[model samples]
Target: MGNIIQLSKSSPTSEWIDMSNQGTDCFLELLIMAANDLEKTNHQEKLISFLKDQKDINDIAPGTAGFKLDEMPWCDETLIDDASFLICVTKEAQSESVLSKLPYKVNTEIVFPWLKQFAVLIELMITASER
Candidate 1:
């Protein structure tokens, strides 16, 4: 995961002054950094670049264990079941055909773990926002 998602903001380039990440809002912090990176790169940067500003991931992220994105709007049955989101993402990452559609190179080793961690946060927000 050290290729892109592992590039720590603190240890990397000292030339570009990184904005403070000490804010209490974890979600807001991500949005702010995304906006900052977008502006600096003329809005042409890959998602991986934004990932570099995050803390290095040294271990595997936990799989789906709570609220599911594929099951939103509980009254209606319109989404995939629990864990299917993770399965689809992993499938796409592993597919050579899907890889061609991406703007950046796909390193399955780096991506799968990132997806797991990302999926959890998404589920958390969905659960919170829906409440």
Candidate 2:
């Protein structure tokens, strides 16, 4: 089974921070870089296809195909929004057979750390943008 990574904010009442124009632009650039990396490795397509197939076989409610790589939130984003997306994707992926597969099982370990780093970056950017 793939390792499931869950991210949670320590406080729910934290003030929401908006990303500065520069920070938003930088986030878009970073997101593109990440998306390109996934595409180059074919992981993006594999994930999409896996989700689609799983939905089909399981008779899962339609529209559970998960988010496209581009549809994922950028770094200058809210924790609640990002966390919700992550939770949804994780649950769908875990319910599918793909989680136990080779690359996915391996990728889980590799990807989660990067995601955590990205989350940290988001928090930092939010703080920086506030000043």
Which candidate number maximizes lDDT?
2
Per-residue C-alpha lDDT of model 1 across residues 1-131, encoded as one tens digit per residue: 11221112332342222222221122223332333322332122322233333322211222111222223222223222322333344344444554555455645554445444545444543454456
Cα lDDT listed for each candidate: 0.33, 0.35
Flag clash pairs in model 1: none
Q: What are the models' TM-scores?
A: 0.28, 0.26
Clashing pairs in 2: none
The clash numbers for all candidates, in the given order, read: 0, 0
Q: Which stretches of candidate 1 lie over 4 Å from their true place?
A: 1-94, 101-105
Q: lDDT of candidate 2 vs native?
A: 0.35
- Candidate 2 lDDT over residue span 1-131, tens digit each: 11111122332223222233332222223333333333222343443343345334324332232222323334443434443343334333323243343232333443444444445534543454468
Candidate 1 accuracy as TM-score: 0.28
